[model samples]
Target: MNKVSMRFLMSMMLIVGGYAFAKAQSAQSLLKEVDSKVKSYKNIAIDFKYALSNEAQGVNQETKGNVVLKGDLYALNLLGTKQIFDGASIYTIVPEDEEVTISAVSDQDENAITPSKMLSFFNDGYIQKMDITQKVNGRTIQYVKLTPMDSNSEVKHTLLGIDTTTKHIYRLIIVQKNDTKITITVNSFKANQPMSANAFVFDESKYADYYINKI
Candidate 1:
C-alpha cells in the first residue's frame, strides 16, 4: 500500500482507540459518583420488583420486595421470607414454615450479594464499560455493563441502569451462564428516613410459637 494510505489507516485506528479509552474512563467516573452518593446516605429504603426467567428451562417468576439498609445492617423481605442482617448475625424468618434460622454473618456465602451490598457490589470484581442510554418513563437511564473478573462465577454479565438525573440505581439485570436472568427494578427509593431503634434487631420473644434454629 502507499505510505499516505498507511498513515491514514494508522490515524483512524488511533482515533478509535482514543475514543474507546475515553468511554471506559467515563464509565468508571460515573460509577464512582454513584458509590459516593450511596455512601453519603445514612440509611436507605427501597421497594423493588424482582423477576427471574430461563427460557430454555421454561422457568419464570416475578415478585416484589423491599429492603431497608443502614451501614452493614439490612432487613430484607422477599419470597415470603424476611431476612435481617444485624452486622453480626443473620436472622431469617419464614412465616409459612413457622421457622426462624439464625447464623453468623461470617458463615454466609462470601460471593452472595446481600441487600446491604446490593448497591455497591460493582465496586470490585468487575470490568465496567459504558452501555446505552434510554428514555424510560420520561427519565433518562444510563446503563453500564459489568463483566465479572472471576472466570468461575456463575454470572455472565450484569447491566446496571442508573437514573441520570438522580445518580441513583434504577435497575439491575444479571445474566447467568445457564441462561437464567434475574432483574430487579427499583419502584421506590428513600434515604435517611426515621428508623425504629430495633429496626435491625431480632425479637425472639415475639416469635415464641416459631421454632428457632441457631447455626
Candidate 2:
C-alpha cells in the first residue's frame, strides 16, 4: 500500500480505539461522581434493610440495620450487635451474650466492607458496566453491574442501583457463585447530621458486667 493510504488507515484505527476507550470509562466516571457527592457531607447516616436468600439451601433471612460514618470512624448496628470503629480499633458488642470484643484493625481486614467503603468499593478490582434504568415509586434508578476480576473470588457479580437525580445509592445486590444472593436496600439516607466527636468511641464503663475479650 502507498504511504498516504497507510497513514489514513492508521488514523481511522486510532479514532475507533479512542471511542471504545471512552465508552468503557463511562461507568467508572459515574461511580466517581457518586463518591464525590457522598464524601462532601461531614457525616452520613443510613438505614438499610439486608436480605439473604439461597433457593437450593432454602435459606431466607431479612433484617434491618443502621450505620453512621464520619471519616474513618463508624458505628454499625446489625444482626443484634453493635460495632464501633474509632479509627484505631474495633469494638463489637453483643447484647444477648453481654459480651464485647476488641481488636486492632489488621491488614487482612482492610479489604472488608465498612460503612465508608460501601459507596466506593466498585472503584477497584472490578469490571464495571452500565446496566439498566428503572422507575420505582416515581424515582428513576440507574444500575451499574460489577464483576470481580479475580477468578477465585466467591462473588459472581454485584449490581448497584443509584438514584439518578440525587446521585445517591438506592440498593445493592450481590450474587455469589454458590447461588446465594444478598441484597441491601437503603430505606433512608441522611447526610451532614449533627454528631458528637465521640460518636464512634466505645465506652467500656457502659458494659461493666459484660465479658470482655481483647485481641
Candidate 3:
C-alpha cells in the first residue's frame, strides 16, 4: 500500500469511531433519565387490569380492576372481587361465600401482590442493561429485564414497560419462582390524589352472609 493511501484510511477510521462513540448513550444515563421522569411524581395512583397465572396452584385468574395505591395502603377492586389493606390488616372479600377474609400483616403469600409493596420496587433495582426507545404504546420506553439481586425477595424477574410520554410505569410484569406470573397493566393514572382512608379499609359488616378465609 502507498503511504498516502494508508494515511487516508487511518483518518477515515478515526472519524467513524468518533461518530459511533458520540451517538451511543450510556446505560446509566438512560436509567437516570427514566428516574428523573419517575421522580416527578411524589406519589402514584393507577387504575390497572391484572392477570395472575399460578401454574403450581393451577390457578388462572384475570381480574379487571382499578388499584388505588399509596404508602402502606392499597385497594384493588374488580366488578365484584375486592381486596384492601389498612396497613396492618388485609381484607379480601369473597362474594361467593359472602364473607371477607381478614389476615394480619405478616409474611403471608398475598403480601407479594399488595399495591404498596410493588410500588416500592421502582426504587429497588439497578439497570443491568438498558436500551431506550419508543414502543407501540407510543411512550418513550426503557425496555429492561431485571434480575432481582435480593435473595430474600419473592419476585424473581421483572419486565418494566415504561411510558415515555408520561414517564411512569405503564406496565409491570412480575414472575415468581413458583412460575406464578402477575402482570399489571396501567391503563390510566393520577398522582397525589386524595384517597379516603376508607378506600383501603374493607368494611364488610354490611355483608352478613359472606365467609372469611385467613391465610
- Top-lDDT candidate index: 1
Ranking by TM-score: 1, 2, 3
Tens-digit per-residue lDDT, 5-99, candidate 1: 99999999999999999999989999999999999999999999999999999999999999999988999999999999988999999999999
Cα lDDT, all candidates: 0.95, 0.90, 0.69
Which candidate's TM-score is highest?
1
* Per-prediction tally of clashes: 0, 0, 6
Q: What 10-residue stretch in candidate 3 is worst by lDDT?
A: 122-131
lDDT by residue for model 2 over 1-215, one digit each (tens)? 99999999999999998876776687788898898998798899999999999999999999999999887789999999999988888899999999999988773254455676888888899998888899989999989999999898888999999998899999999999999999999999999998887899899999999999998
Which residue runs of candidate 3 sit more than 4 Å off their true CA positions?
A: 1-43, 52-62, 78-80, 109-113, 125-127, 131-134, 150-156, 176-180, 213-215
Clashing pairs in 2: none
Give the residue spans of candidate 1 off by over 4 A: none
Question: How many residue pairs clash in model 3?
Answer: 6
The alpha-carbon deviation from the true structure for residue 101 of candidate 1, after best TM-score superposition, in angstroms, is 0.9
- Write down the lDDT that model 1 would get: 0.95
- lDDT by residue (1-215, candidate 3, tens digit) is 99999999999999988765544444344445666754565556778888999877999888778877666677777768777888888887867667787888875764344566555454454334443455664556656566677676776777776665655677777888878998888778888887665676666667766676766
